[model samples]
Target: MSNSSPTAARLSTLDRGLPVWIGLAMILGLGIGRLMPGLGDVLESFTIGGISVPIAAGLLLMMYPVLAKVRYDRLDTVTRDRKLLIASLALNWLVGPAFMFALAWLFLPDHPEFRTGLIIIGLARCIAMVVIWNDLALGDREATAVLVALNSLFQVVAFAGLGWFYLDLLPTWLGLSATGLDVSPAAIALNVLVFLGVPLAAGYLTRRVGERRRGRDWYENRFLPRIGPFALYGLLFTVVILTALQGEAITSQPLDVARIAIPLLAYFSLMWAGSFVLGHALGLNYPRTTALAFTAAGNNFELAIAVSIATFGVSSGQALAGVVGPLIEVPVLVGLVYVSLWARRFFTDSSTATSVAVPVTSKDSS
Candidate 1:
């Protein structure tokens, strides 16, 4: 037998510890804000077009890697598995957002800013980290890749409309205060263009140019591995900066953070469970089910945070809630990976049983 150590496996897992890094970044950012409050203000002051330039850059960096990895060519083939696509889209756009809206109201009825922040998160589907979670759970990576690509594109159009409807129009109908809500579709579209559209176009261009120059093999094997870590670095840096900016609020109202966290925790769990059950009931196989579950469960907190800061001020409770979103999401999704893996056997076994129960044809005996 070949000598193979478990240490390698452990090390490999450690490399994927994004949550730990994000947590550390938050702590460091909080400390920096406490110690050098002036510096945080200066960083926040570097704004252009109603958005922080530094945070915008970080968001772009965080998004580009994942977007570049998408095989746009596979989009045509996604329709071949229409069930998977339909299920994912339904949960992501309809069930997932509506469920979170209810939870936010139920859990945070008094905190409209926090509720709005959560609503923004709900409107934006997962684009980046769902891929990681899908990989960890041995889900269908190709399906997820296609889904994410579609989601990224769809978000540019859908997010703004959904944000207006849920955050502004619906709230007004329900007699909720729509104060400070920038429900202007034009403004929302501009934010989407800045935060998502630019990065998406850049990622596509990078992939195309890199493939043309260095060849697909080199682009995938060499170029991708080298640049992929930048996304994580960007994410951590954004978390730190955002946390630092809001450190005073976080410090003063710890319970407020916990209150914001409650609905988020519920949203993640409910999304995952609902998607999994729906996929299983629809007769989706294990891999497809896992893909749906993970995708629906994960939120594009980066986009949500950027939009929150742009629409609501950086120091607004909305932005603070956006920051808290990933803090709850990263660890919860990581834990769900393990749960998904354990649940995989049950799905597989059910599929096996179904196959066995099918009758054999008499022509086979002849």
Candidate 2:
């Protein structure tokens, strides 16, 4: 299901111009919202029977790229970096969320709106931005692929549980379900597969065909190169429309965003620092260090958004908070990528091997 090395490189280009594309998506979303409000509303809805399928389009639309790069073969190779993977899980699901909860509880309490937003951002892990951040951090794709897949699979359960539990901490105005662990596991699981699995299968299949037909070179040279940028634009446009839709809400509460930004900045710095210390202590080489540090720092927002919309209403502040998570995540992780690269010189190969070398492909990761 995964692409060859060339295909990986080809697919990666979409992520480079992320900021620009995100800006364009904002503009496009605005235009769409204004020119075709009715259609826009429809596009926003994910109806089933009597139910409103909120953010359905956003969830389904953004998965194109996530699915495109999915590699079925990744499971076999995941073992090469077991320590790094375990560290990522510990940090992302456990330590990172814990920090986010504590930070939200600390900073944004006076402003309920921003406090709620921070909680949503904290609980939701990631989808899109992590891959880009991983690359920027000089992480191995094999490692990223394994972690990404596992993260996606976990979001269904984590989203509702974390959202309900944490939002319950807020004042009663939020109306988050504090009652119990009430969301059905099966339903959430189905939605995850629909959003994640379908695209994953499609990406796997596409890679399968491309690899067989013209060979890996053709895939890298042709199709992947073409789709990569378009997909980035697609994801960007999705965010823009989302922002345009929420433009009024966001602008009105500039201070709220300002308030939330601090803990988010703090969260990034803390996670990065933790990873860097751990990477060196563990004796990871440059590539492994990059992978280790990034795995701790990045998130999976898309899955969180989907779960948020499912739990919180479409227009609910909780859902909006979830959307805002990537605003902080993308650029910060990109910065960390270069930071990891610079830190590479500090470690000797012997240190990397003796320190970081647990088991593996035996060479420095690119």
TM-scores for all candidates? 0.78, 0.73
Worst 10 residues of 1 by lDDT: 356-365
Q: Where does candidate 1 stray beyond 4 Å?
A: 1-16, 38-40, 128-142, 152-157, 167-180, 212-214, 285-287, 310-312, 341-366
lDDT values of the candidates?
0.72, 0.57
Question: Over the stretch 40-134, how does candidate 2's per-residue lDDT look in tens digits?
Answer: 34644655522224444444545554445444565565567677777777777888777887787688666555566666666555544555455
Best by TM-score: 1
Task: Please provide, for model 1 over 251-278, each residue's C-alpha lDDT reduced to its tens digit, 9 standing for 90 to 100.
Answer: 7788999999999999998889888988
Q: Model 2: C-alpha RMSD to truth?
A: 7.2
Task: Output the TM-score of candidate 1.
Answer: 0.78
Q: Model 1, residue 105: what's the lDDT?
A: 86
